[model samples]
Target: MDRRTLLTSSLAGMAAAAASAPETRAQAGGSGPPPFAETMAEMTWQEADAAAKSGASVLWAFGVIEQHGPHLPLGTDVYIPSAVLRRARQILAERGHQAVILPAFYWGINQVSGAFPGSVEVQPATMIALMADVLSSVKKQGFARVFCTSGHGDALHNKTIFDGVTAGRAASGIDAAVLFNAPLVKRLGLDTASPAVLGFEVAESPARFIDVHAGDPETSAMLHIHPELVRKDLLPTLKSTDYGPADLAEWRKGQEAARAKTPLGYFGDPASADASRGAARLEGQAKAMAEVILARVGGK
Candidate 1:
């Protein structure tokens, strides 16, 4: 059998074995632990306090609602971060670490898609304020180690979010840290070059699907994560413009180059994306993120 088929079969067998194994307590048998979903929801004030008392780290997924070419949904940024956080939590639990992911922040600065339909753009200050409040709330609950992760590629926006988190940490006197996964992906030696674009990889991986703007990667990820949200047959074929942050002032020049670029707001080839590759990438990202948390919070 091919590598994909073999890997899938092996994973299935391992899952079957795990399912058949008797449940074990965290303190006694040291085997199975509570599933991540049980801890990631919006908890009551008292619940948050109790979790904080347990000294667990809080991971917040920062996302945005922006236009992703013509094929991908506006909430692609939001969903991708959430997926990464969930996967990270699973990995942490397996390693006997107490970490819980929080809901994502969907509003962010979106200059590229500001003109697109259904795209919601927030002021940089507004994003900073909102994130500060969210982190403050988490801090109030006694979570000393606050971790935030963003999937959005806007470097400035992410910096603002991190800055806000820093303000919250200082104001609340809580030991908190924010992580930007796009940068982390690069630090982990992942080939995020033009061909092996991280964004495209995120969409196609098993944990999600490869739906480039609504093409393959992003569409495939949506298919795997929330298949009902995808309008697969209604794929669009409009060309997208290529305008990076550096080309903001020279609009005419950028637009001219954009005309010759790919139709979808995507980089790299999405045709090669598959569920197995997506799953593996997700796992790698989660592991790298967890290590960052551990290092920051005194994990051995």
Candidate 2:
């Protein structure tokens, strides 16, 4: 079977397993209003305190304010993760657990898009330090469990998150895990069984490595969540650039040449993107995330 078909089967199996999964402890707060009631940014300090006292877990959504393509906005990364987290939060609420989503982290390591307009870049070290601080602070606030997620799958971006989580766990002495797009991809059974399997292998798939950036998956997601921001006029002509799979030699080729390889900052056939498919994918992943959240907070 092809990789995509394999992934669909794996995710279906995971979902079926989740259906019979045991109930997890409510570490955030007791049953409250639904997850749709409010976001962390919208919660009052008093309400937050009460939830903490009740053992509410916090969900930190990661998104970068980087260029998507000529057709999509700079906030595509942010919008997609926030929407998926929101869906997971709703599911957690149904299970009598309280979860709150923090505002998106707009500043991320946007090395690839640094040359592109609208990219708010941060040093890798700085992003890691910042994530550590934020997560450590969350633990100090008495939330025993905290979940982190990112839709963007750049190698450096994933490195920052993993590093930050390691640092945060050490500093706070709490349980933490980053639901990186790669592990999600692997868990869903995409790609071969190489120990070095990278997220972009599947994420970029059958296109330029840059396909992970503004490809069909991302475009469809943006269409599902924020069609208003998508420039329909530009979609018709957008196509993957000439950049192919890279080698160690390409790593030495430097950033300028890298951008030159895919000048438009996009790399896949977005023409295939569909909102319904995007919605289904998002829902499945969100369910997987909710299952992980429940297991982490208090499952055997």
Candidate 3:
């Protein structure tokens, strides 16, 4: 069977099995938000206002609708960040700190992925404006700590959003503090020497030695967190390309050469992906993110 068909069939079966399984408050033996049923709706204004009033820290997961390889969902970018935020919320709840997770931002700057079908690219200026407006609204509601998490591959775009939030705070004199997920990811060590590290590449250094895009780490992550979304069986086998010696100079040169050389718009080995790897990466990211939020929220 084709990858898509195989993925669909497998996911359908998994969902059915999940439905038949008994529901529980905790599955991973970790603590955080009380349960999915207990947390408020992540996206609504009313929810944000209520959460702030209840003394909860506000966290937003920024995502984009972009192409992953032929085997992954277009919303993979969105799901990864959202999953991290959800996991963070759970961790914070365990520490007695209430956290309100904002909804995922599916529209983002996706120039590289724009050539692919189903990818939507928002202009950089447009994304900055939208994020500023959202944060402004949240600050006005008295959310003291605002966390911005992104899973998209564009480091520059993510930095723009972070700078925009900083500018918004300065211009409006809002007391809110914004934290981006990229630095947090690095601090957490989830992308350590893995193919997914390329996800951190920017236009300045488009080609990194690691395959950060739709490669092993990313695909593995999807397989673990949202297995239904990955079509592993139907994916094309890719001949792995190394950007020569791994260094900053070579990395930049490789990225420049890659833009002209690779047409698929992805790097890394997807065949090596596994659900267990994704779960480990996700847990690491969540733990590190939770610590940051707690520190920001003044938790001990």
Candidate 4:
């Protein structure tokens, strides 16, 4: 059998066995949420197999450790998307879909901020190889479907991730979908105008597309998710900075050659961030992504 066919057949058998056998319960009892282990780190081989057999979709959280101004933690990008994934898992399970949230991927291409402290940069080629290997292993283990959710938004970072998905397919016939969570929020028309979840639009609370990093959206998110990590004193004094390049290529060259332009290493109006608005942003993103996953790969 071809790789996909073989994997699908194996999954079918496992599902059948799982149906007849007593359910392998997570640590939690009722329908509150899947065990912490099921959604986060420390998942064992048995847990993974059981989840896959139970028709659960594995969700991979992808993010990077990089500079996010002097005020925010270097892991702002990682933390934001991870919060979304955690909430997304709950949303999915509530909707009758079993979803496993994996650990976040820390190493990513930091072309713009590599010169700064606390930024860990991985080359495009290396990232592609690592992603391919990861997908290959997931398929080999028994999962027929996978989804990658990301918070980082550099041009090279996105290209590397999608290329890794393509490479995984070419190298091992692994089928998966990746969603850059921030862009997905915008693309789904959730970024602007009024949203159903909240009484008002969160557009004002987040940074504009051009001023993505350490901006209102991220700062607000951090304020809501991990208030302790945020430097409340700096919010009053921080100002907005724009990345004024016409295109991604120009962005890479300009930022690298002139690091002094963004001495604080942040953009957008963080002063306007609010905890309630940040919570709304998280729900909007999670709900939109959940719909996409259900429509695209939930049956598979």
User: 1-300, model 2: which lDDT tens digit per residue?
Assistant: 999999999999998987778432232233423323356778888887888789887877787888777788777887788888889888998988888777777788776667777888788889878877888887777777667788775667766776777788888775667765555555445343422122321222343343456778888887887666666667878865544556323522435654676577776667667788778878877877777667656632
lDDT of 3 by residue, 1-300 (tens): 999999999999999998889543234232322223233452466766777888887767777887677677777777777777788788999999988876666787765555566778778778777777877877787876666667875655565655656666665555444344444446444433331221221112243456667777788777877675566566557655454345323323433353444456556667767788788778877877788666655796
- Model 4 regions lying over 4 Å from their true place: 1-40, 181-210, 242-255, 298-300
Looking at candidate 2, the ten consecutive residues that score lowest on lDDT are: 194-203
Which pairs clash in the backbone of model 2? 27-55, 28-55, 28-56, 28-57, 29-55, 29-56
List where candidate 2 sits over 4 angstroms from the true fold. Answer: 1-37, 182-210, 240-254
Model 1 scores a C-alpha lDDT of 0.59
The lDDT values for all models are 0.59, 0.70, 0.64, 0.70
Sort by lDDT, best first: what order? Answer: 4, 2, 3, 1
Which candidate do you rate higher for lDDT, 2 or 3? 2
Give the local distance difference test score of model 4.
0.70
Mark the 10 consecutive residues where model 4 has the least summed lDDT: 193-202
Those runs of model 3 whose alpha carbons end farther than 4 Å from true positions after fitting are 1-48, 175-178, 181-209, 244-260
TM-score of each: 0.66, 0.75, 0.70, 0.75
What RMSD, rounded to one decimal, does every model reach? Answer: 15.9, 17.3, 10.9, 16.0
Ranking by TM-score: 4, 2, 3, 1
How many residue pairs collide in each prediction?
23, 6, 7, 1
Candidate 1 to truth, TM: 0.66
